[model samples]
Target: MPTPVIDIDSLTKVYPRQIGQPARRSLDDLRLRIGENEIFGFLGQNGAGKTTTIKILCSLLRPTKGAASVCGHDVRTRAARSCIGYLPENPYFYEYLTPRETIDFYGRLQGLDKATRAREWDALSERLDLRGIGAQRIRGFSKGMRQRLGFAVALVGDPPVLILDEPMSGLDPLGRRMIRELILSLRAAGKTIFFSSHVLGDVEQICDRVGILVEGRLRTQGRIDELLNRRNEQVELVVSGLSAETADALARDALHARRSEAGLHLTTADAAAANAMARAALSEGGQIVEFTPIRESLEAYFVKEQAS
Candidate 1:
């Protein structure tokens, strides 16, 4: 396997308490590896220590035990920090700076040459749709605009990896779509993306793999389809024109059966049972309207693991 762009092993973090309160472990023996050029989604409920893990990886917070490395360099060292572009959940900027100036400032901090800075700025402005308001001051920018700028600043150095915290938070549908496209585009350019999000739909849509964290523990991590398919398979059959007797018989044997305005909905545990149900419906002079396998969704899997 190719070397992991982000590697974490036996990582733990504890927040010191004042007075009588006990120290809280924000992360506990967490282990995760993100491969090169892959889009990996980090998922968890509120206060599940998602932010703590990201902070540790970004060198914003030190782990009490264990180690984390980015691009083969220890996160605690300047070399590893230079390999990542980090966009915090709530990105702050100098109110007086324009989007242009903001990118320039970050580029300077990264010690990028003026020529390199200008080239990256132009490319980012066009890619992130920042051309219209690139000169607008930060104070008056809308949330979505600020988000676009945040992305531009993070990309100024063109780091090989991106670590974004809640990149889609507080955005309208359009804004969310824009960010989603940007993430996909980055992956296409062979940059590793590690991000956290509560929006399961976006995760399902864009992520190559996912890791679920619950209460500071790594609950599960794998390809989304593999995790979802580990559960038992089910099939749904929709039939119409079934006689009352046939409908009653189906309800007695099916996992679930219900009547709706469109048709009778029947759920079975396997394809064989579903085929039998369809044949039975047809023998009773019913018309088959739809037959669909009910695959487990990412949200269902996440919720089940979190609850466990």
Candidate 2:
């Protein structure tokens, strides 16, 4: 088996108890792995320890127990830090610097040659749609614009792995789409991405695998389809021309039923029942308008997990 780019094992973190306060455990015995070149999404409610886990992975906070590694190097070492690019939950920058200057500063810190920094800046600026505002002072940039710049800084080093916290927090719909495309593009270039977000839809759209953290504990983790498919599938049938009595009869085997101007909508968990409902509707001089089978959505599954 190919080695994982990120390996986290039995990780835990606890904040020290203060006067008149309890010692808060920010992470439990959590364990996870992200394979090379994969896009992994971390999800959770606010203060669910998602940020704490990310901070540990970035070496900003040390785990009270267990270990984490990036590119086979311990997260506490400089070697591991060099192999990963990190964007904190709220990235700050010099207010007087322009995008070009900002990226250049990061490039210099990474020990990139001037020529290499120039080339990377041009390429990243174009890829991130920052050409127009590349020379504008950071103080003048909007929140979304700043978020884009943060991505550029994180990517400037061309590291094999990226750790981003709430990368889409300040983005609009269009900005979100742009970030999605950029992330996919990075994956295509063989970069591993680990990011946290509250935008479940975006995570559902792109992540190859996802892990949900709840109250400092890992509630669940797995492939998106596998997790969602665990729930029973449901089918919906829409039929027209059915009398109220016929509709009621059809709904007998259905999980739910509703009336619409065009038809009676019936939903059943059993595919056989859905088919039977359609046949009964046709027999009653009704016209079948639509039949749809829908698996549980990620949001639905996430909400259920959160409740549990």
Candidate 3:
């Protein structure tokens, strides 16, 4: 196993009771271990405590109970802070400052010298497509523009880990793609990434592992294929040389069946049923054309869990 870089153990956060309300727990014994250079996707519906967990990891909020650490250092310490580059759900900026000024400002805060800051700006501006708008004030920039600049700001310190909350919130398709690819490249460059997003499709595309948070608790966490394998997998068996009547007979127990120009298509709840149908078709002098498994998608799983 790779060395653990981000660790959370029995992490719990409870909101204090208000005048008219009882105490509410935002995170309950949430535990997760993310290894070095891993892209861990945090998934949850709205108000599921995803942000609360992220805030605790970023040291923006104290967990009512339990602990969280970055690179083996407590989140409350300077060492842990130094290991992370954070991008909040809504990235705020000095409206009067240009992208160039903003990038340099953050670099300075991270203790970079003039020469180093300039080099950092050059690389980030080019990568984030901020070069053209470098001199333009951010006050009038679009949401996507600010998001790109915010990501550039996060990289100002070249931290070893990135903790992003809704990093793709305001980006267009191209911008989202850019950010997604940038994240993958960052992991390739040895950065550990932990992010929470409602964009299940994007997470499904890039994340090595994912944790689903539902109502302040982690329902599950594991590799995409492994997690999905626990659920029933649908299989489609296609066969040729079978008449409509024969196809109907063979696929009588199938979830759905159809005979098209392509072939006789039999969709079953599991591979075993598909195999049975294929055997029946083959025994009837039919030629097996294909068997395809349609795995449960992250979005489907996420929706079901949230509703559950």
Show where candidate 1 strays beyond 4 Å: 19-21
lDDT of each: 0.92, 0.89, 0.90
Off by over 4 Å in 3: 19-22, 230-232, 239-241, 253-255, 259-263, 269-291
**Residue-wise lDDT of candidate 1 within 81-199, one digit each (tens)?**
89999988968899999888888889989999999888878999998888888888889888888898889988878899999999999989999999999999999998999999998
Candidates in order, TM-scores: namely 0.93, 0.93, 0.90
Per-residue lDDT of candidate 2, residues 117-159 (tens digit): 9998999898877899988899977878888888889988799
Best-fitting candidate, scored by lDDT = 1
Candidates 2 and 3 compared: the better one by TM-score is 2
Off by over 4 Å in 2: 243-246, 283-285
Candidate 3: pairs in clash: none
